[model samples]
Target: MAEETHVLDRPPEGANADWTIPQHWDRYTAEEHATWDTLFARQAKLLPGRASNAWLKGLDVLKLDKPGIPDFEALSDRLMKLTGWQVVAVPGLVPDDVFFDHMANRRFVAGNFIRRPDQLDYLQEPDVFHDVFGHVPMLADPVFADYLAAYGRGGQRALGLDALQYLGRLYWYTVEFGLIAEPEGLRIYGAGIVSSFSESRFALEDPSPNRIAFDMARVMRTEYRIDDFQQNYFVIPSFEELLRQTVETDFAPLYAEMKARADIPVAEIVPGDTVLTHGTQDHARSRAAG
Candidate 1:
């Protein structure tokens, strides 16, 4: 079988220092708006019982349910009032420095493009739906908002230390694929899982992946994969706890120590793991056997 390829959209020639561009909202055709409406309506129906309260409330607070693709200006206006964060349109994925710089300054860089109807279920690169819909909702939460800003600052620092992989894992696990334990049960908070129709269900209900208690050291040392659903999802007790652990702890020493250690495989469960749900690995095994 041939490997699938995805060509990511790039910043137009002569993009500014921040690598941002106008959303040009009027440029979107009705078909594009219809696609957004379809994606929004489907996720809205699926998210209620599965998504974290913070995410659900954010969705409401931002008026994301309103018809058509969101106007970035309007979305930013509301987000600024809620959490001092604003979404900025970029051509697509920007350089790491440009990305972190925007986040550090409370500006989120989103692709101005939406996915085509044929590519609705999955797209390898983040389009506006994945960037804004997947990520921006959680930015409305104050605790997670602060953590992201801090992570951005940490990203800047990590760049100098050549320790981005360690920090990127923290993001992949928490911001993208994380879970949270609520009074009722496990709910989705990670944008990667929350934005996906399938992952939102799989991360919590599936018996194929490890669900372990959040541990700063363990998560930093772990590896993750992008082409498929995650093999592990870390569950946090609360956003406040998540913030405290990341913002308060110093990573300089930890980064220095990492040079001496081997990377932990995505599916390996080490000792002292506060094992929450022991995954059966049935999904992965089946895929491999096929």
Candidate 2:
């Protein structure tokens, strides 16, 4: 999700009023397709045991194993059949309202461009790989699909309530960097964790970040880092419970309550939290100390 002020007032030239443009899948260069393949292969090899069952299932259901960057048209055809979701291309990040509107309608807006080979490990803005590969697989799951659409609808309401920050935190912590407690162990489901080769391991195996149970109020009051791996991860018991809590609760009051409270420090564990792994925070400290 993007902040309203961070994007242009109107769509860029060549984009439609809604900020969408044709994916033009044929235009991707061999080098670009190779970059996608490189990223895909590494993550595919690493994620089998670490990623959530739902995410792995979505990979098979969507046939994401195909070579090169996926054609949004073909990807959407399969996704639309499973969960009424379709992938749309955008110049880059769209206005917050446009994003929410698209999500609310089950249309996911992805970047049309792929990252440069030299910048494979990191990119300031989300590219096709992050937007599609990171996010779309989970969109295939029924419950997660509904949860995202609901988040989009809630985002619209959040704007009216002046609560987009809180709502965005919900997206960042869950959709971006969340973990799920599988029967076998804590598994990665968050797009941010699953998409990157390094973070897929760091988020699960590293003893440097806190893993806490999901709590709506605590999450909204907390802040997160965009520059590095998360110092904290919120784990949900199941997608069903995640959806039930998100859809069933009204957030207006929650937002109001959160606004009155101080923001939770990114790495601090508070009382009443159901602590899972109390991290050493070694990574965060090393980064800071360096």
Would you list the C-alpha lDDT of every candidate in the order shown?
0.87, 0.92
For residues 5-34, write the lDDT of model 2, one tens digit per residue.
Answer: 224567877889899999889888899899
Candidate 2's displacement at residue 189, Å, is 0.6
lDDT for residue 50 in candidate 1, whole number 0-100 = 92
Give the TM-score (vs. native) of candidate 2.
Answer: 0.97
Relative to the unseen true structure, what is the C-alpha lDDT of residue 268 in candidate 2, on a scale of 0 to 100? 90
> Which lDDT tens digits does candidate 1 get at residues 93-208?
67788889998999988888888888877877788888888899999999999999999999999999999999999999999899999998999988888778898889988999
Give the residue spans of candidate 2 off by over 4 A. Answer: 1-9
Q: After superposition, how far is residue 195 of candidate 1 from its true place, in Å?
A: 1.2
